[model samples]
Target: MNRSPRFRTSRTLACAAALLCGAQGLSAQSTAPAAPTAGGDAPATAVLPPVQVRGHYDNDIGTSDAASEGAVTQRLIQNRPALRPGEILEFVPGMIVTQHSGNGKANQYFLRGFNLDHGTDFATFVDGMPVNMVTHAHGQGYTDLGFLIPELVRRIDYRKGPYFAREGDFASAGSARLALLDTLPRPLAEITLGQRDYRRGLFAGSTQLGESGVSLLGAVEAQTHNGPWKVPEDQRKFNGWLRATQRDGNSDRALTFMAYDARWTSTDQIPAALVENGTLDRFGSLDPSDGGRSRRISLSGSTRTTLNDGAWQASAYAVSSKLNLFSNFTYFLDDPVNGDQFEQAERRRMFGGELSRVWDVTLGGREHAFTLGLQARHDRLDPVGLYRNRARDRLATTVEAEVKQTQAGVYGEWNARWTPWLRSIAGLRADAARFDVDSSVAGNSGKASDEQLSPKLGLVFGPWQQTEFFVNAGRGFHSNDARGTTARFSPDGTESLDPVPGLAASRGTELGLRTVIVPGLQSSFAVWRLDLDSELVYIGDAGTTEPSGASRRSGVEWNNHWVLDDVGLPGWLLDLDLAASRARFRDAPSGSDRVPGSVDRVASFGIGYAPEGGRWFGHFQVRHFGPRDLVEDGSEQSSATTLAYLRGGWRPTASLTLAIDVFNLFDREASDIDYFYDSRPIQGGPAAEDRHFHPVEPRTLRVTASYRF
Candidate 1:
């Protein structure tokens, strides 16, 4: 069996060439990067293990006996500073998160190229209770996820691609499920104080009562902070959660409850010029006089039933919320006196509920599995309340507006493990949403319903024991329904003119591969391409409308990491994360429709050192935002920027630790939005609107001390 030197050399060269090619392809699609081995010249990264991840860009793999994907845990969800449920998921790549100063906007989520409508296009659920906003004064919903304190979440799973039916309506692109997994070891508590006069306190406790027939876990956290920035001052939020589980036979069912309170003053929208070129030290902030705040609360529960070799699950829950916007508008005002008062006030209220079920089958052999499910959601919204307009010297005038919208649907998914080496999953789901608006505002009230059907498919192949090849493709859909404006009017039958119903019907796809070379190291890469059609867009003068077709966000990323099997540090782990992506939106009807304010390329990467034995560790994260055009023309609107963050933690005892987080380590200035519309020379050339950007939180430090029993 011994080969000649010439034959051995030729074979070795061929294998090397093939691997090089495969890796190149993977790098361009997957965010997976490669790490250098011991004594090698290449770079190395410490990575989170391939447990399973759910987020906006991918679809469901279900929670069954077959296998479970990675879900964001309570500890992880609470690790960062946030006021609402969506903030925990905002940092994910390919997703844009809109956040006001501090953590006040808890019921709203604008993701995956979606405007902040009713929060319906994206699925929302807690434990098993569906969360939706049926009374979308615009597209705002009643899903107040602000209930779960950073400590209450056992784990959160995100399947961001074509959603499933059992999870219910408004889930064209992805579905979100928040659940409690198990009892914690001990009671944990912490207090955090951050830059800009931010302060937060937290408490948590979990225990197993085998003798009492209960597994209980609960947590409470409250945040009250005054922005060091401007306008949006004196903000506060209180979140609490409780979960109790009872085991019966091969099945275990749990009862969970959550509550939240948030209040804050509104922040003004910075004008275009100041946002684009203002120096870091001179940026304008929301005026302190704007007083807009929202109060939200939710009560929910979910149960699970396990069968022989399979499992069946069902959940039901509801939520209610109210928002008060006592703020001024820079535009669209019909009176000069009220405008001179420098502010206007609007109050909104919303309520909603959800129900769903899921089934699992494992008879197709020990290695194969299948899943089925159905779900429904309902919501009610009051965009605005009537107001008697009275100016300092003018007579009283009455005005009123209301926005109502609801969504319901069903879905299913199937996963297969054909061989020890190959696995795949497929899914389909559909939903219907109704939007109605009535008021003296626009005389544009209508009851319009939109239905969506979507599918998902993905496969993973094991080439070797440690390396797996993967590919995924799915259809994504979102329908325009209405906006969540506190004051706006739509005719009862004006449904045909509603742009949101057909605005979100579009599709996207992705492909990737991963490798683990044995024991302590691994790497992967992937390339993605997305094409959008019938994209809903807007022109300031022409109003909001659905463009003919075509918009996109396609790019490649290379991510990699390694955890040495027996590194000297006992519990210590080394890690690195990297990502890069490109996005663009084109108006098929004409270039004029290609409004600016879109980023072209975005990137992020970082490194960390954690000891295996524990005690203390340090980490650094870096992020890059590509250039963007806020004004929507084909011109450059905002320049790209890079940011860095550093973190350090110390564990004094087995159950106690202290940590510090520092952002903008380099002290660089950044903007949340890009720029303002530049119409200074619009008549001379093409019409253009400049973009106004949201200023970023400046360099600041946050410290937290915690104890976990």
Candidate 2:
């Protein structure tokens, strides 16, 4: 399929988005203030309280528009013993997070039967800053979560499908928003030690700003680790953040600054045949010098103020980040003499902002709400490049480019309660974007533009018997890499190529139910189907995404959160999540409809005990992901993976605590990640297709001590 710039369509959508923003701004000025309360004073807007770590579950049944939407509080995040920073996302039902290389790199994510390689179909945000990078050197929509400090996260709000008006690019499958804490109730100092030369330190505190109604919070962490690899990882990482917040009668405001830096050696996946034949160990590396370094710093601010019978919110952020990564996916396939090691590098700056307003009005003796929002973002990459390397030394340049990408969007939604047992929500969104690239190869330098308009609808019925039913449908999209949107030739200039569409569209529908029929238990189930206009696959050799055939995926999910209080165990909680999905190409021949790397089954079970005023707490968890096809013809497949984790802690006094964490508790010899591709394991050997895998780490234990003042 050939895709060209749609000038007229893009202009029309851009104008529509801009006009909607203007109209909403004008209407908001005429809204009247809410009436005074019984005490003859304006009511204060609801705000989230300060962060506290305890055994508490947030209730979302009565407040959610969809059964697949929920919030995870600090209680769950603090109690879980995460081996990697990105593991925090596992709290989302049916979501899997894994790593194929170094711990400091972006994680491999899978959800809803889609292999969301490096966050293509999943959008993520930290505070108000977007975490997905556009047109990155490594891949499209590359997301790195190493900068996040799990302890500082107050809550994580997640929604599945594209049924929300507030979400835009990269949100076809789902989205997550992480909110940070503004203050700490008590200052804390901690130290941790483990085998394999692991060590870490952390310090955090909060204080008032001289009675100015402003509070200042600061935190810093440093860590080092050497994995169980033949070549020690020798990872070093540092993270720090500072935030200042002020809350007045009807307004809230905050400013935050964050910085992160890391460097590490990676143990890339090895050929399975070699490992099986004893030519290489499971934890061995073909290239010892393969590694990466990254740096990120950002400043952001947000404000929320009461406006008439509603609220207004605004946020803005600026970020500067850089990455230098080196890898050898195909050791000697491309270059038998020098070995096929390559480097990907990028230096980029990003700026973005969002403005929104919500109004609550009564119509015909019924409650109704209307919301309008506008969002804009810009990214500038001074130099994004790919190079051929040998033993960490650059041998030649493949491609280099300077690119700029900009996007703007607007959405409006209306929600109304038709009756005591019936409700409806309807919404529409418009988005537009422009991509410009100046490449070293003149044939690949050009400009392109595109736009899209999407509609969303949801209906809810009946709380009869403590159960609610829902129906939802929506449209969403993800942008392709800027370089791919205008490229006319391959990086090596040896073959011609075709430019891909700037944006690929997706449509989704879901039928779900939420119930609390059993006391102390919350259960939800959803059956969903999603269709894509085009599936963009990552091309490792060219460092870009190439468009593939259209595809369809259907899945079912069951999530349960049970508190054992009513069962005579007041301090115990059990959680179980199960999902199964089928994915296939829409128009593929027989025996080739299967989508590679799409797992069909995922399950997780966790239990924890944390009673109020208790001196001891413990949590145990098990996770499993079923096998998947590795090729179109299903000629090869991957094995299933399962692991267990244990966490236990004791409080020695009111201000001191001790904890122990065990990962891979059963010593399972599973693989963290796997792939099937052509490579030459030995120099000057014939290229052959085989399985490649990164082995899971062996069982490990860590101990931590913390003091609060």
Candidate 3:
């Protein structure tokens, strides 16, 4: 149910006040780390002291199944400086997050040599609830992380490739699972101010109920910003969360509610020629009216029961979301009189549930384990549509439709420790989906169904000298838009369109190594390859993704984390990640084999000093994304991008802290993202092919102050 704006405001304020009051007189304490669920075979959770102390990752050496799988603790997360909530994903090695539009929208993502536009091919979850939306108005698997409150995130578990049975759709490239903290060590309030009129406020607290094993947590956040663009972004956002958890003798359960609302004016990409010839400023907009508004509210619950040497977990969630987006990518290409501006809108309601059980047994003096899981989801979209617009007013309807989609999947896996130094994992998964669409055009109304089966395997060798080797192979799939699977007419109803396949398949293989051979150092490396039956590309102008030719991508990644304490420099940590890949169409001619927008190299380095019981802490980091092919023939290429950030803070007391952050420390002029395409920047002018880019913001600073009771 949707609440009135006034109601939302009142509730937000009430929650904020309640959180502050609940935190009074409560002594601060360190939060205990929880064990990972057996469904994923995750390792134990470990961390250093949490009172403003940073810790290096120490969970992947012998307890992990793959070199590319690991967990990031909250301490590391808190130490990092993130300009936007989505940037938190950067903690995943070799992943790059950028933005081409407003900060309130989903950020663009790149990984494994593929430009995963707005989260395609990557599955993301928050507290067991899937973040990727299928049959979305903007694109398939559109994931928006703006609603996330960075301070509430506890841990991020990530794995690369499609070698795990627990991961389902959109897992071909990788997956990231964000876990929210059940409680905070202390009730806290924070405020921040920055350049470009940026301002934010946050309040959060947790308390236990009397004599019962029940606890409650509440948080609220508000933010506003006017970016450095000629046309101010004028963004406003509000978020709220409430959760209650209970611990029984052998079972743990929790229920959570989350709400988010935001609106912003976008500074979309501009034509390169315009900026080069001084026709437009680097931070300028061709259409100032382009913007969007979004709203989402969700309720979810989860339960877990721990048995002797085994576990059972189950979760259910329901979400209601709406989006009204206006964009003008091609200034005047479609209609010279009214311009090419248009709107994509949708109102969606979705619900899903998951069940899994894991059990261990000893047979013939050998240890063996088995896992079984079931998953199902349904989505109902009312009045999902597209329309031509001049400014923000609709001029003509392109297409309007209602859709119902349902999907279900089941998986089973067997793990065996055949020898003291060897193990094997094998799994199989089957999924099916049905889509029904009611369209404004008769030819586009129909029903379609499809299914897929995937098999997976993994082998692990000896952990000789604190090092382990792994080999994995698997198949994964991503679902297409429900409308695309049955449509026979284009959005304009002027041309006949052939329906695309409902599901696209992918196969992946990897050889990996993980080691802690060097004291204070944890390292992992992987060489992997992925082959897609059909490549998916997002079409910005059309607000949808299209299936392209088959393609292949191969890459290698190296990740390292070091705690300087072993080297006699306590409280210092260093990290480095490097990746390089090659991507091409499988059947294309030699000259045209290159995949457009495929990144070839990426790297990041960071050093942080936050000694235990220290009064001062600091962190500095740098990231680089190598140039990429902007066109199929490789004639056009994008420029490499490099950025630096710094953060320094002082703790004046046990309950008070202040920090300052500097972004783009070098003030470098670079593009956040680039596209080579045809556009008409002027009315009645011929469309010309040129590079379009979104420039990065200039060097900016932010100051934050926080207090705990």
lDDT of all the models against the reference? 0.47, 0.82, 0.82
Name the regions of candidate 3 deviating beyond 4 angstroms.
Answer: 1-55, 537-540, 543-545
Candidate 1 global CA lDDT score: 0.47
lDDT string, candidate 2, 157-209, tens digits: 77889887778899999988777878877898889898798898999989888
TM-score (C-alpha, index-matched) for candidate 1: 0.75
Better of 1 and 2 by lDDT: 2
Clash totals for all candidate models: 74, 0, 0
Poorest 10 consecutive residues by lDDT, candidate 2: 35-44
Q: Which scores better on lDDT, 1 or 3?
A: 3
Please give the distance, in angstroms, between residue 150's alpha carbon in candidate 1 and its true position after superposition: 2.3
lDDT of 2: 0.82
